[model samples]
Structure formats: structure tokens, C-alpha cells
Target: MDFHALQQRLRRFANERDWQPYQTPKNLAMAMTVEAAELLEIFQWLTPEQSLNLSDDQRRHLGEELSDVLLYLVQIADHGGVDLDAAVERKLAMNAIKHPPKKS
Candidate 1:
């Protein structure tokens, strides 16, 4: 998928909701954390097998919560004027520098 296009689509979604006012960078950051916590709640007390066996309905709910988190994260990154792709590339470059190929 084209991440930039996806970002623009998310922006349009927020615009349709008139939610941009509440979606300041700081607020989006907080909302992302809150939604992430909600996603985690789904797995709070289940055994590994039970969690893994989540029904379609349960999975759909979890997917909604995860989407909420991702929406907020993407908005926050956009609001902060951060180029997420570039940031990820820079981090990977730093990791490469730190963890070079081992000698034979």
C-alpha cells in the first residue's frame, strides 16, 4: 500500500468527522495509547489457547480497537510533521551501523 496515500485518506476521514480540532498531535498521542490499552484488555485474562482461539466477533472487535490506535498514531505523526518512513529508515540505518556483519 502507498503509506502516504493511506495517510491522506486517514486525514480525510478525520476531516469528515470534524475531529481535527480534538486531534492535536499531543491529543492523538494520548488517544493512541488509550486505544492500545483497550486492545490489550481483550487478552487480559485468557489462557494462551483461549486467546489464540478468539472467535470472529472477538477478532473483529480487536481489529477495530487496533485500527483506532493506528489511526491516532498516523494522525499524530502527521500532526508532528514527522516523516515516518524517513524516521524508520534512519533508525534502520543506525541499527545497521551498530550491528555490522560479523567476521568469518
Candidate 2:
């Protein structure tokens, strides 16, 4: 799946509904953070084993919440006129430089 294309489609969907006005860069960023916090709530204080045992219903709910977070993050980047893929790549490049491979 082309994430860029998907993001574009989602943007168009929102535009058609006149939702872009509410999705200013700052507001979208805040929404992303809120959704992330909601996603985190599911795992708070839960051991790996306990979390893994979550029922299908719980898993589905978590997945939806996680997707919401990602969508808002994409929207935030889009609203800010940033290419998320390139931004992430640039950050990863910096991280790679910061944590270079160890010599044998």
C-alpha cells in the first residue's frame, strides 16, 4: 500500500467535508498526541503477557485507536507542509550517524 497515496486520499476526504479548517497544523498535532495517549492507555501497567492476552475485541479497539493516532500525525505533517516520509528518513539518517555500527 502506498502510504503517500493513502494520505492524499484521506486529505481529499477531509477536504470534501470541509474538515481541513479544524485540522490546522497545531490542532492536528494536538489530536495526534491525544490519540497516542489513548493508545498508550491500553498498555499502561500491563505486562507483556497480560497485554498479549487481550481479547479480539480489545485488540480491534486498540488497532482503531492506533490508526487514529497515525492518521492525525499524517494530517499534522500534511498541514504543516512537511513530507513525513522524507522527514522520517532524515531523522533515521541522523540516528544512524549517532549510533553507528560497532566494529567487530
Q: What are the lDDT scores of the predictions, listed in order? A: 0.87, 0.86
**For candidate 1, what's the RMSD?**
3.0
1-104: candidate 1 lDDT, tens digit per residue: 55678789988988999987897888888889999999999999989899999999999999999888877777787889988888889999999999997985
Q: Write the per-residue lDDT of candidate 2 for residues 1-104, one digit (tens) a residue.
A: 46678779888999899987897888888888899899899999889998989989889989999899888877777778888888989999999999998984
* Top-lDDT candidate index: 1
What's the distance in Å from true for residue 37, model 2?
0.8
